[model samples]
Target: MLQVEHLHKSFADFKAVAGADLTVRQGDLVAVIGPNGAGKTTLFNLITGHLTPDRGRILFKDVDVTGLPAHEICRKGIARSFQIANIFPRLSVFRNVQVSVLSQKKLSHTLFRPAQTLVVEETNRILDSVGLSDKKLDIAGSLSHGDKRVLEIAIALGNEPELLILDEPTAGMSPDETTTTMDLVKRLATEQGLTILFCEHDMDVVFNVATSIMVMQHGQTIIQGRPQEVRQNVTVQEAYLGGA
Candidate 1:
């Protein structure tokens, strides 16, 4: 569903992503695992159109989207969630999701009737999918950290993306919360048939949830294969496992 060929991005004097190539098939759950400065996020930025690649092409479905704007890329059915909780502090959970639904319809005008009334059914369905239906009326800022993470996912789901890019979905959660988040992500991929590409630090989470894994080191792909294949790779062991 997504193809990135010979991608490269540099910042002034440093190369963040160098000659990276990857392909994510429909309904596949792929994990991009690497240490700090491994350029995982940089690759995501380029794919999502937050950063334009200096070289190579980004093809979504079959069309080139290398230089497209972020919103344009999103409209093409790719949605991303940040490593941090990117939620509105003052808005209610319902309102936050309603905004995403409205944006998808190009209804940015706040005065375009009441957004809640306009997209209430659709917003509730999205929130329900992410397991946040009960918290819809709660103030977003008042939710616990774990709940906030779920809310972030809910907001991303509001776009009804074909390919979901989650940046550290389980980043700061407790053990239980991390497990819950992983389960939700798995369901999204397997049941909802959404293709998932995520950058994660937790080895257990990556191995457990990823259908395939790509290991990056020094801004380059070191290994790409199934979990068992990657786990036994000599270079992966030396670079990531041993370091872990």
Candidate 2:
């Protein structure tokens, strides 16, 4: 569903992404895993238009999306959640997602329409999908850190994206919370048929939920393969897995 080829991006003298290539097929739960400074986030930024690449290509469903503006790319069916929870903390959980649904439907400025009545079902459905329906009326700022992250995912789903990019979807979660979040991710792919690409530092989470894994280091892809293969790779062991 998405293809990134030999992507290179640099900041003056720092090469954040140098020759990174990745391919994510439809219904894929692809995980990008690497140690710190591996440029996983930079590559994601390039693909999602947060950062323009110095050179290379990003193709989504066969169309070149490289260098498109972030909003334009989002309109083209790619939605992302950041490493940090990005949501309207002051808004109710429902309102937070409602805004995204409204934006997606181009109804954010319907002055004559009562915004409360707009996309009610859509917002509720997204909340339900992310297991946040019970918290729909709560203030977003009051949610637990893990639920806040799930709220971010729900907000991304408001875009109805064909490709969902999650940056460290389980970061900062407790053990049980990590399990729950990753389980939600698995269901999104297996049951809902969503194509997902995520970057994570949790080895257990990556190995347990990823259909495939790509390891990166020093701004480049070291290898991409099934989890078992990656776990056993000599270089991966030496570089990041600590020979485990």
Candidate 3:
């Protein structure tokens, strides 16, 4: 569904991504893992157009999308959630997602029609899928950190993405919250058939849920394979897993 080839990005003398490569197929749940400064997020930025690549090609569904603006890529069926929860803090959970749904449909909530009546079913369905139906009326800022992250994901779903990119989806959460979030991710891929690519620091989370794993080091992908292969590989163990 997505291909990144020999991607490179730099800031001054520091190469954030150097000749990196990644491939994500439809219905596949792929995880990108690396230590700090490994360039996972930079690679994501380049693909999503937050940062254009200094060099390389990005293709989605056989079309060259390199350097496309973020919104254009999003409209092309890519959606993402950030490392930090990005949501409307002051809006109710329902309105938070409603705004996204409205934006996706290119409509604005004018005084003539409150957004409340528009896309009601679609908004509720997204909230329900993310397990936030009960909290729909609650203030977004008042929710727990985990719920806030989930809300961000629900908002991403508003874009009706074919591929979902989650950066550190469970960066800060309780064990239960992590499990809940990962379960949702798995369901999104297996049940809903959404292609997923995520970068996660939690090894257990990556290994447990990912259909494939890509290990990066020094700004390039050193290994991309199944979970078992990554777990046993001596280089991966030494470089990132702390295996002797």
Candidate 4:
């Protein structure tokens, strides 16, 4: 559960997030949608501690977390994947996930015992959930773009997140790959009871997977509602959704 109240952030006269507020309840698969320069990513940065808000508050589970460091927020059960695939290029898929698992446990790999061996089963389970089990031994950099994205998600799941923030999860992918990724995300929300908040440009993905949608424009959240409501709203249509 997360609550953002009157959040604002700016960079030298350009307001990236202007008085935005929203609440994400447990088990929500919420989508944040908007056009370019809409401040979607900036809002995520504020919540995740990449950028401290200039004003307002970000609360998770009744505790105020505004201005907490990114690592601290992550340890508090928030995890994210970036717009670009953030993977360890040289690490094997299994090892990449093992790093996250070990990081979550506050242990670093040393020559004495490889972290991968210690968390092999759990790491493999994450890989399997993301449908990358077969690529476990493959180098992360060598995988296709879609697979790389999946790997990044596997790493996020390693943190055992209560809320997963995915920035452009399907930014570049074939339709099939996109569908696979959406299905995997939906399954995680359903089976694992994970809460999700994602910023996405793909309307199809947004409409299909999101239980609720928030439309942002000019650095502010202008509309927040269910999929059908967002689709038919005249203001949202003109502002962002491009409805007919």
The superposed Cα distance between candidate 2 and the true structure at residue 226, in angstroms, equals 1.1
Ten contiguous residues with the weakest lDDT in model 4: 108-117
Clashes of each: 0, 0, 0, 0
Candidate 3 pairs with clashing backbones: none
Which pairs of residues collide in model 1?
A: none
Question: For candidate 1, lDDT tens digit of each residue in 1-244?
Answer: 9988888999997999988888899989999999999999999989999999999899999999998999999999999998888999899999999889888876766555575466888898888888888989999999999989889988888888999999999998999999999999999998899999999999999999999898888778887888999999988998899933
Q: TM-score for candidate 4, please give it.
A: 0.96
- Give residue 26's lDDT in candidate 3 (0 to 100): 92
Model 1: lowest-lDDT 10 consecutive positions = 108-117
Model 4 segments more than 4 A misplaced: 110-118
TM-scores, in order shown?
0.95, 0.96, 0.96, 0.96
User: Against the unseen true structure, what C-alpha lDDT does each candidate score?
Assistant: 0.90, 0.93, 0.92, 0.91
> Which residue pairs in candidate 4 have backbone atoms (N, alpha carbon, C) closer than 3 angstroms, thus clashing?
none
lDDT winner, 1 or 4: 4
lDDT of 2 by residue, 147-222 (tens): 9999999999999899999999989999999999999999988877899999999888899999989999989998
Residues 152-238 of candidate 3 have per-residue lDDT tens digits of 999999999999999999988999999999999998888888999999998889989999899989899998888999899999999
lDDT of 2: 0.93
